[model samples]
Target chain A: MNTLDARGYSCPEPVIMTKKALEKGLPLTVMVDGVTPLNNITRFAQNKGYKVESRAVGEDYELTISK
Target chain B: MKNKQTLLIAATGLVVGALAVLLTLNGNPANMGFCIACFLRDTAGALGLHKAAVVQYARPEIIGLVLGAFIMSVAGKEFAAKGGSSPMTRFVLGFFVMVGALMFLGCPLRMVLRIAGGDLNAVVGLIGFVCGILGGIFFLKNGFTLKRTYTLSRLEGTWMPILSLGVLALLLLAPSLLAFSESGPGSMHAPVMMAQAAGLIVGALAYKTRLCMVGGIRDAVLFGDFYLLYGFVAIIIAALIGNLAIGSFNLGFDGQPVAFNDGLWNFLGMALTGLGSALLGGCPLRQLILAGSGNSDSAVTVMGMIVGSAFCHNFGLASSADGPTSAGKIAVIIGFAVVIVIGLANMRKEKV
Candidate 1:
């Protein structure tokens, strides 16, 4: 399992980073501070044959993606 | 389920409009909230690139927008620097786009903003913008392309962002280092903190959605894709709602602030904007975002805008409410010719 912390960053980037992590064929936990990125990363993963589960951790979100 | 994406995008549009209205209510000019071209021109004037007294301010919103976008790009691990995609051509297109935008006194964002605030003058500019986009679509159909940009070192992408941060710092710590207008639009601004927050939100959301108003219209025209247009439409709806709530909605052509009454040039001005921006492959806002994200080609285009603004101001090529200066009208004609030539020259023909 890998942790991808993308807190305080905006979209496209977090999603872009999440895409890279998913491409590594590993289960990953992604932290995103922005609502836009949280939804975007989850959508990108779900669309790419991965299951995504996200939970709020304080003001940020933690998203889990696994094949 | 089907409208999920549309709803999501429209939400971002709503945020954009909300902030824009908030800024206007907080002392930003009426019908002049968040114009990339105007802000860029004002920035250039602030730097003494052109001695335009009435429009000189190192707008923190512009700095914050680029800086915010750049920060996001880096945080997302997507800040790759690249360029050489007909950079000079892009610069020229950016230049003319600025020329056209200033002549009419706004960008596509401002055009929509104006309409949202009930200025009918923008209605004409909107028509011109559509037509200009149609012209670009014609060239696109004809195989006109500015080519592609290749990846460069990551450090290369840091320059513009660094520059923006530097500007932000200077504006904050050393106020006298940069010029600020004592009157006119340059002098008008929302509180610095509010402006920066608005710009940051907009920059970040735009990055996430890949929102491009011109792209939305172009996609709708080219491929019947209304996905993006939904977001564009949402901005207007949200803006109108915001303006009404703030008691800023005017509802007419007469007495619109920072807007010209001339219909034809308004049409032609935005026609030039639409065509040039279409040819350059993005609106002024998109260009700023792209530059922030480390695309040097876009950086070049941004520079072109700055230079274009200076040239327009120095050469008497910008229009005002009284109407376009004769020089501005002449520039628009020349601008059309330059853009058409660029279009024809770049277009490649497929062999049957």
Candidate 2:
């Protein structure tokens, strides 16, 4: 499992990072600090046909995306 | 619960729209209240950053907006000092956004208001704006990004708010220090305190609701999310009702107050604005709110806008009611070129 810390990034940035990380193969864990990024990454990952599981990790969100 | 939240967002839009109309009725230019680009240009003129005599004023609404967002963010525990995410790039994007906005004589927010006031020229602008956003969405799907931001000291985040307060102080205590328009759009204004109050109220609501016209349309195209778009639609409806009630609705393209009937320039101008704002991750109003909440990158963006406003007037690149100047048209073309280059340059190389 590869974890990408996207905790402080804003929109489109997080989604882009997720796209880049997904290129290296999954299951991938993405961490974000806000709802906007969480929702954005979830949307991006789901749109790409990946299964995404998201949960709160102490005021931040962790999303696990897998094929 | 989601329905309630959506309704509250709509209510916020209504209040904002009604305030805009009230501001217009109370002395602000007809159909010309709360234009972020115009206000920044006026503020630039007031500061002597540009010699545009007819548009000089230290607009209190701008100050109120920043301070309102600052107070709300602090109270909500949402304020965080952050920056260092390609500040110069954001600055350039901000500058071009202002360029496009001045060319069109409004921002996306004002574009909506113009449509509500029955300016068909704005309808043409809207079509251009949506086209630009769709273009941005293409880049977004291809992994366009401006990189990530870093956390900074609290003092770094407070600079914009402090600057806002300093401007407010100057506007109140030392009015003689800044230039005031003798006549024209700058000379016409709502009472300072009333306009400030209106800005404060709208700023607070907008910050809370994350009301951003660029984000509204971008999200709609990117994620099928209409959450943000609903706010803008509500604004149009509310402002439409207010305009009709006040007999301010002219319902035509020609002779609309403070707007030109030139459809092509209006479209291209807003197209540039939409593309720039989409690349910057927010619109001018959103940049202001983000700056208030301690985003130094956004503060730099706002500064870029001020400078851009000055540049537009100083170099004769801004349009007037007579319509877009030749220089302004060329600048808009250059703006599109620069923004497109930026969009292409920022795409992840691997993805491209």
Candidate 3:
């Protein structure tokens, strides 16, 4: 499982990073610092047919994407 | 609870729209109150960045907007110094967005106001604007991004707000240092204190509500989210009623104040504005609000807009009531090409 830290980033950046990382294969965990990114990444990953499990990590969110 | 929040946001829009009308009635340009692009152009002219004498005036509203957002964000504990994601790119995009806006003689907010005043040409511009947003959404769906931003020291984020204060001081204490338009659109303005108060109220509300015309349409198209769109709709309704009551609602393409009847240029201009704004992650007004809240990237974007405003007026690329200049048309085309190239270059490479 590869972890991608997308904290401290704004919208579309986190989603784009997630898309780029997904090209290599799934079971990836992405860390984001805001709700906008969390919802956006979840939507993007789900649209790509990936299962996304998101959980709160204190003030941030951890989203795990797997096929 | 959500309904209350929605009602509050709608009320905010109504207040903004009504204030725009009031500002216009008090001497701001007709159907031209609260235009970020036009006001910025005037600010650039006042600073002597451009020799467009008719448009020179250091608008107090802009200064007030920055300070208002700064104060609001600080009070809300939402002010954090952060930036460093493709500053130059945002600068260029901001420049092009100004070009497109000046070509159309307004920003999206003004476009809405124009429609509320029954300017049919703005309807044409609106069509183009939506088309441009759709084009941007295509790129966004394919993973367009400006990359990551990093948090910076608090001092770094205070520069824009400080600059705003400095400008305000100059406007109030040293009026001789800035140019004032003797005639034309620049000369027409509400009283200084009134304009400043209007900007402060609108800016604080916008900051609280996250009101953005570009975000409104983009979210609606991309996510089926109408939360942002509702604010704009409220603005339209509120402004429409105000314009009608004030007898300012003139329905025609000709003889509209501070506007031209060139439909093609109007469409292309706003199209460029919409696409550039969509790619930049915010519109001109949003950029200002963000800069107020300590985003240096948005500050840089605002600087780009000022320079672009100067460039438009200096080179005669900005339109006038007479119509769009040939040079203005060419510049808009170049702006599109440059923005497209930037958008293409920044996207993540697809797997081979």
Candidate 4:
């Protein structure tokens, strides 16, 4: 289970980073701070054949992307 | 991925545009909403680069944009501090982009906003922009290139943002360091916090999507891709709705605020802008965003635009409601010739 910290970041960068991580064939947890970034990361994962489930805990978001 | 990107871009455009309309309603200026070149000119004037009294303000929006993008880029771990991509060439390109935009009284973003607000003059400008883009495409196909940029220290990317924050500090604590117009276009602005917020949000969004009108059109033209264009189309539609809600929609061409009816200059001016922006690789707003993202080449371009703005106003080369001065006409003509020469001279040899 790999963990990626993408908190405090903005949009496309988080999404791009996530894509790179996925390409290396790793499935795990990604953290995004903002609603925009969280949503974008989720979609970027899903569109690339990954399953995404997200949870918000007190203003921070954790996304689990899996095959 | 493509569809989601389009949706995000559209959503960003809608919200940002609504803010622009709201700002205009709050006394920023009609059809004069969210113009990068105008704001740059105003900032240049504020810094005493030129003496255009009516158009001098260190727009908080521009500062916010740079800083916000800086913050996001740093946090995203996507910040690359590099440049040196033909700085002088880019500077001249920025100068001409601003000149062309000023002649038409707006950048491509503002052009769409204007037309959405019902300014018909922008249609002609649009035509010119497309033609210029077509010319630029001709050069690109013929191997026009600006060569590769060498990477520099990450500290290089930090300079633009650091400078932005310092300016923000100055604007907040020691306003006397910079000159602000007591009246005229410079005096007109949305509230500081509001403009800054708008700029910050936009900077963040732009950094993410890499939203660029010139890039979008260039892609659409050269590669037959509409992914970028979709975002722009959504922006216009969103702006149109915003204008409609506020009764800012004035369909006819004449009597548009801060703009006049000389259609030829409108066309020619935007043509210059289109070509210049294409040659330079992005529009003025994109340049600002890229500067925030740590591109030093873009920083030089921004500086070029600032100086060009000063030159235009100081030399009586900017157009007014009475229409373009003869000097402005001559400058536009010269701008076209110079841009064409740049396009032609910069072409690379075809590969074997």
| Candidate 3 accuracy as lDDT | 0.88
The segments of candidate 2 whose C-alpha lies over 4 angstroms from its true place after superposition are A1-4, A15-29, A35-67
Best by DockQ: 2
What does the lDDT read for residue B17 in candidate 1? 81
Candidate 4's docking class is: incorrect
Candidate 4 per-residue lDDT, tens place, B1-352, comes to 6577778887777766777787788767786658888888888887889997889888888898888788888889767665777789999989988889889888888887888888899989889999988888788767666765555788887777887887788778988988888987789888888888888888888777767778678767764545557667777887788889988899988998777789999999999999999888778888898888788888899988988899999998898777888888888999998999998888767610
Fraction of true contacts retained by every candidate, in order, equals 0.00, 0.38, 0.31, 0.00
TM-score of 3: 0.90
Interface C-alpha root-mean-square deviation, candidates in order: 11.5, 3.6, 4.7, 11.0
Clashing pairs in 3: none
Compose the digit string of candidate 2's lDDT tens values, residues B1-352: 3466568779888987899999999999887778999998999999899998999998888888888889998998878888998899999999999999998999898999999999999999999998888888788777687888888999999999999888888899998999999999999999999999988888888878778888889977776667678889999998999999999998988998888989999999999999988888888998998888888999999999999999999999999999999999999999999999989998877662
Q: Local error of candidate 4 at B271, Å?
A: 0.4
DockQ of each: 0.04, 0.37, 0.28, 0.04
What's the true lDDT of residue A24 in model 4? Answer: 59
Considering TM-score, which of the candidate structures 3 and 4 is the better prediction for this target? Answer: 3
Give the better candidate number (1 or 3) by DockQ.
3
Candidate that would win on TM-score: 2
